[model samples]
Target chain A: MTATDDRADAPAASIEDRALALLARTRRWHWAEAAFWLGAAASFALLPDSHLLLTEIAILGLFALSLDLILGYAGVVSLGHGAFFGLGAYVAGLTSIHLTAEPLTGLLLAGVAAGLLGALTAPLLLRRATDLTRLMVTLGVAMLLYEAANRMAWLTGGADGLQGVMIDPILGRFEFDLMGRTGYAYSLVVLFVLFLFARRVVTSPFGMSLRAIRGNSLRAATVGVPVGRRIIAIYTMAAVYAGIAGALLTQTTMFVSLDVVAFHRSADVLLVLVLGGIGYLYGGLVGALVFKLLQDGLSAITPQYWQFWIGLILVVLVLIGRDRVPALWRRAVRRGGAGA
Target chain B: MLTILIDGIAYGMLLFVLSVGLSVTMGLMNFVNLAHGAFALVGGYVTALLMNRAGVPFLATLPFAFLIPAALGAVLERTIYKPLYSRSHLDQVLFSIGLVFMTVAATDFLVGSEQQLIQLPTWLQGRFDLGGVAVGRYRLFLIVICALLVVGLQYVLSRTRFGSRLRAAVDDQRVARGLGIDVGTIFAVTFAVGSGLAGLGGALGVELLGMEPTFPLRFMVYFLIVVTIGGTDSLTGPFLAALIIGVADVAGKYYVPQVGAFLIYALMIVILVLRPQGLLARGR
Candidate 1:
């Protein structure tokens, strides 16, 4: 490592200087990333009929991104992230009904609500516990929320779901239409802005510390990384991101339901993050696109039994291997390099 | 109140039977299996199919329910689940969930989405007044059968050579293997037996829990709750945990119908917060 680094940079460079340079290198945008976003923007005109689907994908992507922040980077495994997402959706819906039709304000309020809940629950997760305990706790919390929503029929509309969640359009100009053109644009903009922020967070030193903590919390703690505090901060931040995504869902559809807080929502987001490849910000977006498209195609084929096919896919994917994917990708790349 | 307690004990016993296998696999193999309920579903359906179609008596069909799922579990463990033992918890969870989805959908397609009915014999039907507390004959039968099964299981696990080997393995795989124990064979047998027990529980629970295509998805959380609360170390923990959950659920539903599982979920979270290892985790 020192030999290669000496040729590329100055031999006298300090370890800290070399580390800063490496961090800077990771922060730079790749050509593929620029093209990815460009393609997403182009979809507005190219796939005009699919805006509704695109909007769903965007919201799902953001939700998956929130999960990735904790699971991938912070090494926290959650089976009930839908709690925050649902909380955000319900809060946003209620805010719209009782307070304001302004979209962004509702989004902010929803985020704050979710964030506060996250802060309250974050300590519960910070305790020394096994993955099983964490999974059960998170799932239990979500189930409690689901029960609350079900019992509070008057407020949350019970099983019937919240309705009449009307919203004013972006800056009171562009309205959410039947075609979902405005909704798609709004969602995409939010996704892109959030994605940029996530990208920055992951590339920074804070992100490095998170990765360190994930690798070995004990070692990171010994190295003075403030492991618990960092985990709480990231977890809370991820909750806010999820909340915003849920709020976006409520705003776009103008509805919120018990399904938002359901176990399946959490499971689906985890699936999306895993499918895209964790630890990377764009994994969520790519995964969301693939999962959404797959759902659309499969449901069209057999609406009643589409889940069977998805199950088959998951089984096959795991059997074929998942953790080995990066190694396989590298091997293919190396072979291409050899051929070149 | 006594009736509720009796009913809760019956329900809890059924839960212990259903989830004990999950506890075995999860505790011994350290695999996060979300599809454990699928085994129970298969057992329940086996009973439902035989009783409804083949003129087979409900009592006679119980053996087939146990054997069939046990055989299926043995084969699947050998073929599909063997490699996953060493995989990460996430992979295990995904694999099991996939299995669950496939099972649920397949059941839905084969049998209509409607709930399956198991025809109980005249002997197992109706309520019997036992000392002033009116008890359903079926519930009483369930309690007796489940209690016997639990006793039988406790005896097998505590007294037998196989049980000792299994315990050694759960302590440390490497050390157990070094001592020349056939951990693989033990695990396969345990897995099959666990699955068989789950099936039996499912078959017995047909009158209570109701057999449906979405059975696995509906009851996954309950099974998990039992396992997590009970801890995987001993049968006693899970047995007691299942009883607590069953009683809490029955009483909660009976008295505060409006709460609808809120109490149970809250209880699980609280227990986990206080004892993250479980109700009866051994000190390391």
Candidate 2:
């Protein structure tokens, strides 16, 4: 009730108090968000056979969410986010094969590994540069990693991909089965937990600083925000998110392929993020759901030539203008509210 | 070593011709046309189809290859790309990438996934030894044609009336428009010409780079590298960058084939880190 009640007392409140109220308002969960999560949970029971597909949606959603953190929130354009994702996957695969098969531990290791790589690479991305430069560097780094993996055939299994990955059960309870039920549940749980963490982070004061930086870095710097450091932090955090998503894929599928780090993976995730909408926390989740469904449907219709349609949709979407999409969505929502 | 250098120069020249068009579009309009390779693919396909199916000589098909993609580029510029010039870089990137995907899929559907080989005339097929450096007749022809193109492009860009107008347009579009320059037509023409050049390069490079449905996606990074490293301001930067990349790539492949494209990518990252703008970028 604090969110609803604070607006009534806003006029008399001090500047700090009003800021607190605004923050609280943003932090308040909407009914739609609750319903979405509830639906995700409900699907576990309602759509038992589609758990495998749902699991892919969950991982992709997380991956897209990671991209959203930088591209959507922080205004950083990256073309090779799959670098961290692939790294996480490769790390998880190696850990399962060479060390332990414990799922949580593998996830932790993957996240840490990706985070470290992100931290190391953050400086390279944080330099005074254009978006094109960022794209080339990010892409170049990913390609370098791909080539390295391809060369280190002894360790990575080369072009054939790293196989023989064995993942243990979730907390030593349920075993992974052929139907992928456990995988879906496990991935969903990880996604939900991470989503909560991301939501909390984005709603905080630091997140506001990121928004300010995104809007105008020069002005943000003049306002006493450390633009460079904030970018590095958010980028590293996003990398961890992507890495965790990759780790989930490896854990569920028990195989890591070169395609994980392929250029298409990066492009696909970008498309998903764009489809779901950007900036908002739920965009990735929504986008992943829509993208996966679209891919499935399109492939079903024309397995080989589905990319043409996907490309057509992207072209049409952009031609219509991404800026117009939110306006249209808002209009529909307003009309729906009136009907309700 | 000499043979590698010759091959490298030939490869570099081919890359320059393919990527120079991209540099102009990116520099002048600041539009990130990631689908530039698609134009090249069209040219390559044109050459292959003409040479194989129609029994046309390779030389005759080259003009059609250029003209067709040039027309395609002009139409696309006026219709699809013109509106996007004012959009954000992200939008431009996505739009072009969409074009790339469409072209790739469409090419695959039409031609199948196999690489298309263009039969070079008998005269252009054989290799000759020049001062102990073995050189293919096709490669030498490529180097000669591309070098001529570079010279011609430089002359057109620097010494011609249209070149100065294009330069004016690139420098300050608003001012150029105020000074009675039709910026839109200039852009459309430049874009078409760039696409035509790319087509020519694709036609010439089929034997060397190979032609496939995924041609755009495969060589996209290389084209981007040339533009970024060459600096989008002038023709010389991309030309030089292409040559450096060409030689380095050839030498790298020859000396340490296992390392593959890793060295070139690492070098690009280092260069970008060192000079964020480019190797020969003009002062803003």
Candidate 3:
């Protein structure tokens, strides 16, 4: 509000600011670690027969996390994240069929493919677009890809889906088993590693710049943040994450279908992320778990009306408050803050 | 070619009626309601259920389609949508999408997941051949009804005191309130009419678009395309945009039967990129 005092100067003041920033950045949030351990420990011990569901949850968590990167931190709204996810799955599926099936390499390749696609499309997408514009553009891109895949059935297997996807043993060591234990464990490891990487990124200086941009893009630009470039970079990075999530799904399931590229994937992930609460690092993970569990429990009871329940939840969530449900961990945070 | 044009016009007219109310709410109220499609679905189901089950005449069922949804919409607006006028677009999208999901599920549970058939009256069933081309009897009916609706809507929106007040309210809520315009009532009425139009469109379009539990999700893109591409401010923009889209969709399907809806989607992307404010929005 005070424009008269605006100045970036004095080496001593800048150094002191840097020191303060470093201390604030390095502050440890206990809940994130708590969530990781709780998910890893509880799922394995409790649901021995639910490896497949757990694996799916893990993959979805990662996908939701990717959405959080742009939507929560960078203020970029995309409605077609499933494009990268489907692309990653298909790319990884093709790689397994046509190249090596090393899990890490496939994931890496998927991430790169999605990232490259994001980089190429973003300039076109980000051009003079607002919320509604971005939403439509993202959706348009996804639909275009979907139609292309459907038409090129020989390559994408069309509606029949890309079949005969056989992945080799991870690191040529642990073989994928019938019970899906290996898939669950593999996905858990990937989730943990990526979660670590994301934690590091969000806690860094660049992440703070993203928050500033989200709060006020004009002010951020005035303060020397390259707004367009940063948005593009984060969008591309989110795409890579989504791609990797897709790659994980294909690897675990050994199948890639047109459904992977559908609008519901994007919508579902967004729902899960927001359900856990936007902007929090672990929101995606927590949302994925709760959403999957709800789906499982509700579907078992009223199989035909499961969607109705989900819809009811959404209406209630919106009506009551965005911060009310799914993010139960907030209580812990609040209680901790109060105690301190 | 002429048949495609006719078909496109009819189709586009249907899109306009279904979505114009949405345009009013979105443009004037500045609220994004993705649940607009659900109103259409409700209308379609109402028409189908009454006509098929109760032996009601199709014409008699049309009023129910429009009125029932309008009533429901009015109630919903007063209750849920009022508070969301100030929320972020993301929240609005989520809330509406959730409603859509519930509506879809509820419809599926109630009516079964099978496609609801609209048995049109014999008078509107057959094709009317003009020169060498055969235009659908039902499509002609659609064009007439939608055109009348458009004229009525345009007249009410542009020529009526209510219209000016509504527009004034949209331009500035506080100023309109200061002028003693009941903005809330205007919005509620508009929301009802919009939902009613969606119902009428749904009832009209069931045969063309196919009505299943997933109708809302499927034709959502088309409705959004019409609204977004047409621009936000005026009815003519969406009307013209809908016409072009209808023609494009019909032509695309006719010529490249294998390509399906790819052209329309691609065109939408191009239009959106070129004119983010919409094809007809005046520069701010």
Best by lDDT: 2
Give candidate 1's error at residue B247 in angstroms. 0.8
Misplaced by over 4 Å in model 2 are A1-12, A327-340
lDDT of 3 by residue, B1-284 (tens): 78889999999999899888888888877787888999999999999999999999999999999999999999999999999988878888888889999989999898899999877889998898889899999999999999999999889889999999888977788999999999889999999999999998999988888899999988888888898899888889999999998888888888997798888888899989998778988887
- Cα lDDT computed for each candidate against the true fold: 0.89, 0.90, 0.87
Q: What does candidate 2 score on TM?
A: 0.97
Candidates 1 and 3: which is better by lDDT? 1
Deviation in angstroms for A104 in model 1? 1.0
For the predicted complex of model 2, DockQ is 0.80
Residue pairs in collision within model 1: none
Sorting all predicted structures by DockQ, with the top scorer first, yields 2, 3, 1
Task: Encode model 3's per-residue lDDT on A1-340: one tens digit a residue.
Answer: 1221354453455754764466365557566467566868678768879999999899999999999999999887877999999999999998888888777788999999999999988887567857778888888989888888888898989999999888889989898888898899899888888888887787777787888788888899998998888888888989999999999999999999999998888788888888888887678888998999999999999988988888888778888888665456777667766776
DockQ of each: 0.74, 0.80, 0.75
What is the descending lDDT order? 2, 1, 3
Count backbone overlaps in model 2: 0
* TM agreement with the true structure for every prediction: 0.96, 0.97, 0.94
Model 1 agreement with the true structure over B139-187: per-residue lDDT tens digits = 9999999999999999888899998999898888889999999999999
